[model samples]
Target: MMDAALQALKQYFGYDRFRTGQDQIISRILNGQDTVGIMPTGGGKSLCYQIPALLFPGVTLVISPLISLMKDQVDALKDVGIQATFINSSLTFSETNERLSAAAQGIYKLVYIAPERLEVSGFVRILEHMHVSLVAIDEAHCISQWGHDFRPSYRAIPAMIDRFARRPAVVALTATATPRVTTDIRKLFGIEAEGVVATGFARDNLNFQVVRGQSADVFLLDYLRKNRDQPGIVYAATRKEVDRLYARLTQQGLAVGRYHAGLSEKERAASQEQFLYDDLTVLVATNAFGMGINKSNVRFVIHYNMPRNIEAYYQEAGRAGRDGEKSDCILLFAPQDIRLQKFFIDQSDMDETLKQAEYHKLEQMIGYCHTETCLQAYILRYFGERNPSGCGHCGNCLDTREKTDVTVNAQKVLSCVKRLRERYGKIMVAKVLAGASEQKLRSLHLDRLPTYGIMKEQTQKQIGEFIDFLTAEQYLVQQGGAYPVLALAERSLPVLKGEARVLKKGHIRAERLAVDDALFEVLKQVRKTLAQKEFVPPYIIFSDQSLREMSARLPATDHDFLMIKGVGQQKLEKYGHAFMQAIAGYQAEQKNAVN
Candidate 1:
């Protein structure tokens, strides 16, 4: 079974070897063990089930959360000549029935279904007639209440599995899962000891940053202008922000698209299609975007606001650098983002316990934003994993921070908060310190305080940022309510008494991660043309990583081309000639120039 799975991997999926955790998960599944794979994004979780689906004698059932996700995976599978189909709300009743009929007739080697379909009697009855050798659950974290995106429909999966005549081997997969979530999935799936597989969550190719105290619009425009040619996503907190950023970027002459729930379905689809086709270099979206996106060449993912939790941010930011190239994952944070997230938590349907849990998670995200430690290590630790002492690739680890002693400045802010009796939020505090003549300040008689205007030289943004840093460092605490108040934490005493020094990272220009290679550009054009001709995503044809390898190696023969990482037997046969021709032409030109 292992050998056959490997053969299928080469022939169908176009890979030379299994990625970390895939081989173990696949082997465990092939041995008929209930398995749980907790892999990070870009960890090739699909191939674990896909390889076994080919090796299994009966059809493999894949339970996915989104139609777009199923369609993307099934389309990629069918492109490699695998028989795969998905049944979901996107299909008409007749179309769904026909596909179910095909599945029963053994027309598809794998069938993808949304978890909600498990509760449908008709869907279950149809599945009962088919031989399902394995059940693969994508986004399996949804089954646990502790998970970031819990779905009640996912809970029905166990009952659906019991309805099968012969219980198929179960394999649950998720990109982000805490130890609790991992245990929940295992218990839910009846996976036994040693049945869990996981890879490190740290993505070395990704450089993480938290860009606070900057104008999000100005900073975004500057970053985009510098990295204009790169494909990226800008994630905002709300649809209004998405639209606002979209309009601004569009007016600025950047090739940008927008995605959010407020947009018409057709508009969202069109925007997603444009981004997938490389027609749009920047996609400004809310958290609603990127759940099912499989685009591999995204060079950056910038969060306009910090997400409510680390899980969501990691998954969203993981969308970038999927091709194993260096990419930026930046969060343009503000203290108000905490309030925004709290507002969302308050509006949620979850009970008080769950809401409190969510708030705790939000606090963790806040900690991440305020942490001076390695960003990657902090994230890894959040996910219940560990990494080396220093990543050296993140904003903090880059050591480019211009540290300034803000001890005196910090005392003034803390003292100001105390003098006001901690009755206000960051903006008001910043304003009071900056001596902004606001009517509210006059009404409150805040200008009478001796601490007022002590830091008048600092801008509002700078003062707000100092408060955020203090809040993060526990020198100040932001109360959570309808209107948040600022209060001093126990740690504030040291700064107030001059017993401890306070330092903050000054503005450091982020290092641009663009690799300029003429040959790479030429190969990309060839890939684009081929993808257009074939009517597939360019990354599906060849990832940026593959193209870079091709450009570097300048493979002249089919055998040499096959040596490239992403080139499998089927892709080599389908695309070997054109790539070889391009490489040969470039090599000849270089030789001629040298002569």
Candidate 2:
């Protein structure tokens, strides 16, 4: 069975070996044991069930959270020569029934359905008649209320599975699930605590970066100009910022698109399609974009503003380099971004407990922006990975800027926070430190403190940023929800007692992804033309990774073409001639030019 799985993997998906933990998950599912797979994005979670789906006697039901996800996965599955179909809100009633009837006839090896469909007795009744050998739950974290993106619809999944006369072996998979969310999912699904297969949450192919204290717009424009041909997503916190960035990039004549909830469905879908088809090189969107997006050529993901939490940031940023190529995850952060996130938390309808959780997450995100350690390690640590090693390519690890001893400056900030009774936030402390004669400060007599005006040489903005750095470094901690007060942490005692030193690095700048070869460009054009003819995204034809492989190997024969990593029998039969011909033509042209 394992050998068959391996053969199916290469014959259909074009991969010879399973990614780490993928084989384990697939073996468990094949053995009729329920499993939980916690792999990072582009970690081949889909293939765990997909390969099993091909080998199983009955159809594999994939319960996804989004309609777009369903469409994307189903389309990719079909391209891989697998019989797959999706039943979702996008389909008409008759169309849904037609697909369901097809599934009943065993026409599809995999059926992708939204979770909400399970709630409908009519749908459940239709599914009951089909032979379901496996049930794969994508984005399984949605079932946990503790997760960043929770959907109540996911809670209906276990019950839906129980309704079947013969319960299918269940597998839950997600790219971003913290230990808490993972535990919650295990409990709900009755998965054994030791049964979880986590491949760790580290994305070694992604270079993590956090850019602070710079003009975001200026830096973005500069960075875009450098990597103009690269496909990337710039995520803003709000629709307004998305619109602003979109307009600015458009005015600069960049091929960019925007996606947000504010746009009409048609507009959003059109923009998303344009992005997926590679008509646009950059997409400026809010968090609403890129969930379950299967496009594999994205080279970078930039955060125009700080995200509310690390999980949201990681998931959004993970969208880059899905093809397993090196990519950048850049965060452009500002102090106001924190306040803006806080404002959102304050205005949310969540109970105090949830709101507090959000605040705590936000604090961690701020730490991410300010921490001088390896950025990738920080994220892994956040997700509960123990003592994960740092990727030496992130902004902090690569930062060669001069370090200045800021211990005295940190002491002054801590002293100010302590003198204020640990009740004031950054702005108030900055004001008092800068000797601002605001009515609030004068009314509270905060100006009379010994630490007041001690940092008069620095601007209020500088003091505020220094305070943020102190908080991130653990010398000061932000307490309270919404409007948090600055309090000295245990680490502050040593700094105040002149036993600890604080060193701050200079500003870090963005770097460009590696440039592609000329042959790779030619192959991309071939892919674009083929995709246009087939009415599919270019990646649906061949990923950037595959194209690069082709360009490097310069395959000339059918046998050689099939040896390319992503080339399966179906893809070879369907697209072999065109790509092989293109490669031969390029070789001939190079020969002629040399002659």
Top TM-score model: 1
Model 1 per-residue lDDT tens digits across residues 293-367:
789999999999999999999999999998898899999887678878989998989999999999999989998
Which runs of model 1 end up more than 4 angstroms from their true locations? Answer: 386-389, 415-489, 591-595
Error of 1 at 33 (Å): 1.7
Q: What is model 1's C-alpha RMSD? A: 2.6
User: lDDT of each structure?
Assistant: 0.88, 0.89
Name the candidate that leads on lDDT.
2
RMSD of each: 2.6, 4.2
RMSD of 2: 4.2
Clashing pairs in 2: none
